[model samples]
Target chain A: MKTSNKSVNQEAKNSFSIKGYFLRHIQVCLASLGRICRSPVSSLMTIAVIAISLALPAGMHVLIKNIEYVTSGWDGAAQISLFIKKGTTEEKVVNLKNQIELMGQIDKTEYISPTSALEEFKRLSGFGQALDALDKNPLPAVIVISPGIEASSPQQLNQLVESLQDNPIVDHAQLDMQWVKRLYSIMDIINRGVMIVGALLALAVILITGNTIRLDIQNRHDEILITKLIGATNSFIRRPFLYTGILYGLLGGIIASVLIGLSIGLLSDSVSKLSSLYSSGFELKGLGVDGTFTLIAGSTALGFAGSWVAVGKHLGKIEPS
Target chain B: MIRFDNTTKRYSEGHEALSSISFDLNEGEMSFLTGHSGAGKSTLLKLIACIERPTRGQVVVNGVNISKLRKSKIPYLRRNIGIIFQNHQLLFDRTVFDNIALPLVIQGLPHREIGRRVRAALDKVNLLGKEKLYPVTLSGGEQQRVGIARAVVHKPPIILADEPTGNLDPELSAEIMHLFEQFNQVGVCILIASHDIDLLNKMNKRIITLQQGKIIYDGHEMAPKSYHNHENIQ
Candidate 1:
């Protein structure tokens, strides 16, 4: 009975120690955050540095996404206009349209008879009187083929045009691909630029955070030595600094999110107005929940990694000698 | 209990701090170490605390051979030994209460237990009312008292102090010695290193004197014909 009671008491003490462990970590986290709050100017400066670095890439990424959205909207109406051979009858043009429509790669195909094609051109061209003086109809029957929505890339559209050009009755296949290629190339360049800038800025964030943490370690040099002398584990000495880094990272992430949100809010109105002028339904996209979470999570991770590196390098050098 | 068997500490700079010195301090015993400025007194204490491992030989503190102990186990070993520095090493940023509560906090004690023990330690050191005051606001003696409070708060079995009263007046130094006596009465083994011959002679405890990285004198305190006999020093 005595041994059993002793074991039970020991178990209680063990549980209490476990509880204290978590409680201590929570206390350290709060204390570190409070320290940052106490030094608002310096903390804000550090956070601003981090936020700017984060926001540049994140904002550029959003811009790229919006640009892609606009381009895709423009590409939706893109079709390959295949002018049928002049000697071909309207029956051959309709049959070609039917055949193209039945093709798996074509979403839909429309056939315009020679008379209607000439008539529609005459109505819009403002050269109607001049065009009526012609002895024979100059316009050919045309088949306009829209590629499947799955063919999103310019390369895919070009391939569709190439296939349509191979039709025997087709005299010419025309696709306005210059603008599409330019848009894609521009987007590609910007995307790569964003990645390079993001990577470099990410490295900068790590170095900035690391240097700050190193300075903190130096400032708290005496405190760290005292704690170590008093049997504080290296982990205990390291905990507060880690939390400080995490706080900096989390705050920077939040600030970047806010900056991106404000910029989007500022530009969204003009962008939508311009879209209306062009009869396109494009809108600026802000960092959504996932984006905001990723920003914060990513920054916090950078902070953690930076501080981990700093502490691991410097904490071992300090001893209560 | 502390035992050193032929311990030696040689720094990376090729300077030998403590060389093949051996000593045994039993449980609950109080002693003083005396030496000149560079007599390896601090190095010996540091070795026992596991702050610096000995270059050669073994250190067994409280039945554990700590010379071979892993770096990961150093903190656990130090938790059983409380050390006081000459400078007190109190953090100026925190209040005396937090300073005194450091050891217990390091142990991850509950806040209530930490509060109870910190107050108890402060009461013992006669600095109970100054808990809210920062270390910089305290006098030399009071700062040393705060260091003592921190050292004892965790109730470790062995206490080591390195020139703890180095900055205090004779009166305050005696008072600090009185405090150590009070702790020694409760069976806390203590080893204090000091250069003050007057205080060492007055305490009448065992004296272990070091000279140039070696133990030259390790015996009971012997009183001279006159307590002020300067010629009989060392």
Candidate 2:
């Protein structure tokens, strides 16, 4: 009988301890949740800030990705113009044009005779009578050179032009490839700038979440004191807060993603119209899966990290007192 | 069981909050920690609760020196002890039933069990009918009762009450003290911190006094003669 009673008491104690274990978690979560529910205004405000901060970087990220995706194929449009001096002979110009055509780097070359250039300029400029007064045609023969895809870079074309400049017949050789290089460089710089700004804003989102969590910990100061006194471990106390952070992060991330998608959707039509106007058949595209996934993971990580930082700092000082 | 062995807690700038504090509360033994506001009574309680770490020495509770326990272990230890505060610290935002149900919920009890336990605890505090009421709507005394109900809802083996009746009238104070005594009768070791000398005189429980971060008395019923100068503690 003694042993049986003892065993029963032990079982009761075990049951009580197990019950206690489960109850603590529910208590902390409900407490934080109740606080959130009570102040819907503040909670919403915080969430909005988080979402907006997240949206800035997320939007920029999507835009950069789309721009990169659309432009990757067209980045190699290198053009070269072989300029001749005003006094160059038409026969020598033809000879040089033929030489460039036979080179492996040349795809297509068009020769403009001095007489044909003078007539074409007059016809296009609507100034045909003014050119008739000149005793000698002042125009120089030129070659419109198209560099093959293999020799698409500015350096390659520059080298080609320099080699041509050494010829006695060619007075001057100029390649109009600066525009392509300049455009590509500007786009590259802009993309990098967007990424840097995105990273900084992402950090800001995390800090915002952390600050919010810290306030939460402070608001529950009484409960925290009680919990600490009761022998609640710091991790146990921090768990629900961590969970809150993750939830905030995830919700904000989802919101940010939606916001980016909506912004893109709103602009996609206008962009397509504009692209069509430019005759490029371009559309303002949205980010693909790889980019979207990156945004989601980054946003979620920001939220989790924000809450974790807040929990870590606040929980540290919540000793029983 | 708890034992404070030469435990001393000093502030960051060397202000001593507790000095060489040593005491032991065994299984089922009830006591009261009474002193003035700065008598280190609350600090002693905080040390026991592991809310504040001891700057020096050891605080062993349930065979673990809480001073040496990792942050993760505090909650597990807290599960074994219950705490009630002067603020009644009941979340005014929630219903009384939910407040009382907190500790049990922390233990992750099923919904039905939580409902049952909350009902039982509310009944003990005589606030059964007011279970759905918010703390803000309750009287000061009723709020304290709600706090008490929350403390005992999980049936923790040890309870620490910090000025449980500091805000109540004499009649309500007696009522609250009676509730603590009843829990004590049931083998739940109770330690109350208060400056209620008149009430302490009425209850025949052990009284431990603190004066300038030092223990001046450990009387069975009232303040020891040596603790006469420490009545200013709140």
Candidate 3:
């Protein structure tokens, strides 16, 4: 009976201490935040530095996403144009177009009669007077085949063009793939460049936070010394500085998001106008929900890491003496 | 309780601050450590507090050999022993109440318990109603009292003071000594380092004197006159 009573009392004390632990942490967290709020000028300066550093990479990321979005439709533009033999009958050309459209890899096929092809050439090439002086229509009936998305890869497109060129009625089949490959290469390089810049800026953010926290430690040297003398644990002395770091990072992330949002808002109208001028329905994409969340989470983690390093390096040097 | 077994401290600059010093302070024993400024009174207190470790000997506190205590364990050791400084190391940016509440905060005491204990300590130091005032606004005596309140707020079993009354007037210094006597009466072991000959003579407690990093004397009221004469020669 005595042992059971003592066990119950021990449980009560444990629960009480657990509650006290959380209470103390909450107090320290708020006190750190209050310290930042009290010194608005210096705190804002540090936060602004973090926000700008974060914004550069985040802004580049948004630009790349928008660029990818704008160019996404060009994948379907890898069409194969088949020039038919000059004397092929129009009926045979139509039949050939129908046959190609039924192929598994073909999206759709358009047949252009020799007459209409000549007229389109004259209108587009500004050579109507020169064409009128010719004795006869020298143009050939053409069939344009758009490959399905699954078959639009460079190798598949090459295979389709080669197969079409072997047909008796087709004089030549062409697929303009060089420009597409160049576009992809450019995109890959830009993506890699953005990644490098992002990594460097992240390092810069960490260094900035670390330097700010170092200054904070120096400023509170006396407080830290006194607290240590009074039996405050190193963790207790470190708590406020860590919290200050996290708050700086959190606030910086939030402001960077806002900055990105405002810039996207400013650029939206001009981007829409440009796309409309090109007769395309493409729209610019901003940092969506996932991107914003990742930015905030990453910045907060970096802030924690920076302050952790600073605290470990500087807090131990402050002995009670 | 603190026991020093032939403790010696040497700095990296080839200065020996303390050499072959040995002493034993019992539980609930109040004693004064008196010496000239450079005679290593502060250094001895620092060794007991684990702020500095001995270069050569064993310094034991509460039966733990703190001369070789790990760095991570220093804070726990300090929590069991309260230390007061001559400079009255109160945080000037905080209120008197916050300064006194720091030790309890470090111990993770509940909010209500902290308030209750802080008020109790403040009452002891006769600063009951000045909790909201900042330390910078207080008089020197009041500030020193706040430091004392902070040191004892967590109720450690042992207290070590280094020149705690150095900045006070003679009357205020006596009052502080009286406060230490009251704490000692309640079974708290205390060792104070001071060079005030008159104050040490009046306290009527065990006194230990150091000179050139060596104990020249240790006794009660019997050695006051002789100690005074020695100081006059120095």
Best by TM-score: 1
List each candidate's DockQ score: 0.43, 0.29, 0.37
Best by lDDT: 3
Q: For residues B1-234, write the lDDT of model 1, one tens digit per residue.
A: 898899889999999998998899998999998877787988888888888888998888866676666676577778788899898888898999998888887778778999999999999999989999999988889899999999999999899999988999999999999999999999999999987888888899998888789877777755333322433564
Task: Mark the regions of model 3 whose C-alpha exceeds 4 Å error after superposition.
Answer: A1-18, A81-106, A110-143, A148-174, B224-226
Highest DockQ scorer: 1
Total backbone collisions, model 3: 0
Candidate 2 residue lDDT tens string, B3-39: 8899899989888989998888877777888777787
Task: For candidate 1, write residues A239-262 as lDDT tens digits.
Answer: 999999888889999999999999
Write down the TM-score of every candidate.
0.87, 0.70, 0.86
* lDDT of each residue in A10-89, candidate 2, tens digit only: 53345455556566656656665666677789877877788888788667767776676565545345555666887777
Chain A TM-score, prediction 3: 0.74
In model 3, what is the error at residue B208, expressed in angstroms? 0.7
- Please give the ranking of all candidate structures by TM-score, highest first, separated by commas: 1, 3, 2
Question: Count of backbone clashes for each model?
Answer: 0, 27, 0
